[model samples]
Target: MSSPGPRRRGVSVPRPGRGWWVPAWAVLLAVVLLGPALAPGLVLSYDMVWVPDLTLRSDFLGLGSSLPRAVPSDAVVSVLDEVVAGWVLQKLVLLLPLVGGALGVVRPLRDLPLPARLVAVSLFVWNPFVAERLVMGHWPVLVGYGVLPWVLLLGRRWRVERRLPAALPVLVVAGSLSASAGVVTAVALVASVGLGSRTRAAVAVGLVAAANAPWVVSGLLHAAAGRSDPAGAAAFALSGEGSLPAPLAALSLGGIWNSEVVPHSRTGILAWVSLLVLLGLALAGGRRWWSRGRRDAATLAICWGVGLGLALLTWASPDAVAWVAAHVPGGGLLRDGSRQLALCVPLVASLAAVGTTRVLEWMEDAGAVMVAAALVVLPVLLLPDAALGVDGRLRAVDFPRDYADARAAIDEDAGPGDVLLLPLASYRQPAWNAGRKVLDPTGRYQSRDFVTSDALVVSGTVIAGEDPRVAEVARALDLPTPDERADALVRAGIGVVITDLEAPGEPPEVAGEPLLRGSRLEVSALDGARSPAPPTGWLWAMAAAWAAFVVPPVGVAAAAVVRRRRRRDTP
Candidate 1:
């Protein structure tokens, strides 16, 4: 072969095979991304709650609950609690997905030099949308966001290579853990299946359906029982803040409705800058891809178009959105259409990476380095505390000592029966948690299975499971006569009544003698004890579906490991 042509002047040469470094970069990126959470003290606020020495339950597949979203993180928390503090586990729960997200973004861009790749990864992980969601305490959704890129990557691989990537099942399982993320992945997989072979598409569809069986089955089972919240759809409609263009802000990923979660300053300017930069870079990358005829360019372009279109439809076409939400079962689950922007994040990151690499191709190595440095540093300047703790440190809140003791006492005396929480409410702002907003902890803290009237009230309407027993208990608490209250409690099958002494309003004094007393809570036993509702047929179906989805993948992974070990030993 003739001598290679002279290297082009001022063109930065690509590094030789930096694929191995992707994982290392991902780990480092995670550490940087989670810097605020890694602070010395626990950072708890907005939906993050960890009680010291509390027992964690593994009943994630139980029917009529969305708690399955936290199952993976809860498992990690349980393990991490064995060595480090529980709060550390909570931080890791947030950090791990981010690391996964970064890795997913970086893996496809391994052809680029490390610096440009890092810039792209940072751009994806440290945007205003991510910051707002983090501050809003949507960690599970964040986890899904992190897992999404990998799902797309593996899906593409399966289609192009005509063989299942070893990681597909794992990513499917991980993505399905988050309810919203699971839906997004399913949608993406369905949409992208046309790119692959028929076999590959069928396999992808099957795995996605199986992975989502838990929530899918649960949702289908309770479809008739639950109602839609139209107001919730209206409140969480996708739109920009004051004076900002909705489409531009959405593409920039900064249209969070909650002012509390958004940065006080720089939001408007940052949105404009981000939109312009991303759009310019994407256009440049599109031109490059068009010239080269790259399939990825088309794939990413489709995703971006679809994501932006959905977001716009939700923001600009409220009637269309409302119609979809009403007609489609569980479509109300996506009441926050802003979440659909998650689909655009990876595509934008990829295009940004391509644009960075293209720009670097025109510069000398040193100039490329300088530009890359600026790209990496840009996010920090625009969103200073994006990666750090949102709002403030999350100090660990302990349950009242007496509350724990009372739970113990109730466990000893009260047989198997459901506990009723008072004053009846769907949500709670506990004094112990420094008044942080959280779902009522009665079901989590009580010794026995607990029932609360707090249905998931979406936009002032009960959109999920509603127990008339919860209503009966609420009425019982309102009764002035102790005997009438006691009768009502018995009828509702509330064997044990636990009242939050600190709750606003006077505590109910039932006729029954108090069985356990504490400073924060008091428990009294009903004379005619009632048992908890038995597990429904749908629950069994859900459990079976989860088992089928989880077990086979685990077995396949194990077999693959065993085969590798066998080959290594033979060699």
Candidate 2:
């Protein structure tokens, strides 16, 4: 499996000095791209508050949140096991891939000029989506996506040298672990390596499939469990789910692309301008790059084309989205469907980076320094601090003054493992920063996310207007219907009821005690019901598995360092 030498079809191969600019350019690019994210002010704190709300509920209820019970109580319990541990762990997860990527690129870094290394690292660091993941505490998804380029780099190295045993397996595992984002990451990696021979591509595909087996198996199990509906396959080809205007609804989403200044009335000139620029670049250089000149760029274009096409198809036809969505292991839980755009953002950024790099290189070659500088400045001028920086808006979880006061009051009355019934929205806010669990966590409105086979317990399907078991649970609680069932939830040993507005019909307060009260939220405690305890067996098993998974990679890397040293000495 000898690697091919660089072709001369107007492509810039990694020559000793010529490619040095790539890394430096990449970093500068990252800084610029992330400028808005690192900017001073905050935007709307929607996601931050929301995700933690799920965590808080899970902490109290022990798999009681809307998320599937099988989602591993460890996921939520991990939030409470250590003091301020969750945030620290999340930050580390985000950094791991970038660090791993740097390690993976060591050989290439040494071989390439300093400038190229700088540019490459910079490009990776400045990627807008990557920045977003780090700031938002999307540790799992970010770590998955972050390790991707390194996997591609390793795979490419293996393809060139036939080091299949090592790199191939690593790529597979990386891809599987990143199941949701990894799908796109795998697509990008494969495309990045498309510059190699066809035989290599075949092997890579096979290896990728083998590695993704875990995710595949998980999906199968979910489907078998009736969490997914196979009937949705027909939706993929069906026409008229909505108009193009429907897909464009992302325009209404605030906080993306300095929407504050741009004003996302769907008529913002800046968005239109950005689109035109992207289109013009694609039209101007897309075909030339795709032709035989730069195979990697061509492959990237195809990957982006596929992702975008799939996104649009889903938007246009629910059937299309539903078909693919249903097949995905946890796909049914995702309602936005636009979340697929999270995949597209990086692909688009990479393409834009390539385009930027090429255009600037062309300008420099033509000695148009002033024009090139202006070209760079235009992007700088157009993009704002909010679009690129760590503004408060990006912080999804922040305790509002009123919410904080209420939580303090409640904590005085309640102990650990108590349940609360309040507006899901109130719980959605990041203010309930208690390291313990709450009842009825956020994001449970989905179908497949929560379930229990026990006749006494109801699954998410039952609660989310789907499963019949929900009605049963409602009746058992002495409530006639689902809505009343929610109101009646307090009687089921809810230690607290926190809400701004009281329910219309006064069923009278619980006999327990008033925990806390603030302007908007209220916290009440229940009198009876046993307090919850830790799952000793589950915790021990999880801790053991966690240790097993973490130890070997570290040991292997250390052993490699020693082995290389010994070999060098013997030689």
Q: Judging by lDDT against the true structure, name the best candidate.
A: 1
Per candidate, the number of residue pairs that clash is 4, 44
Quality of model 2 by C-alpha lDDT: 0.40
Q: How do the predictions measure up, each by TM-score?
A: 0.85, 0.59
> In candidate 2, residue 368 scores what lDDT?
37
Per-residue accuracy of model 1 over 155-186 as CA lDDT, tens digit each: 77666667677777877777766567677777
The true-versus-predicted C-alpha distance at residue 482 of model 1, in Å, is: 3.7
Worst-scoring 10-residue span by lDDT in model 2:
451-460
How much does candidate 1 score in TM-score?
0.85
Query: How would you encode candidate 2's per-residue C-alpha lDDT over 1-571 as one tens digit per residue?
Result: 1112222334343344534354445444544443433332222232221222223333222223222322222343344435544434433443455555434433233433233244334434433334434443344455555556556556556655665434345444544443445465567667756645778778667555554443343333334343434333222221211121433433211122212222222234443444455454445434433432354445445555655555455446656445554555555433223323443443344334334445544443334344444444443333333233333234313334555455556556563334443332222223333221122332221111222112111221221322333333334345555345444443333444454443222332434456656654555554443333335653454344434333444554566678779999995
Best by TM-score: 1
Pairs of residues at least 3 apart in sequence or in different chains that clash in candidate 1: 42-394, 43-394, 44-394, 426-454
What overall lDDT goes with each candidate model? Answer: 0.65, 0.40
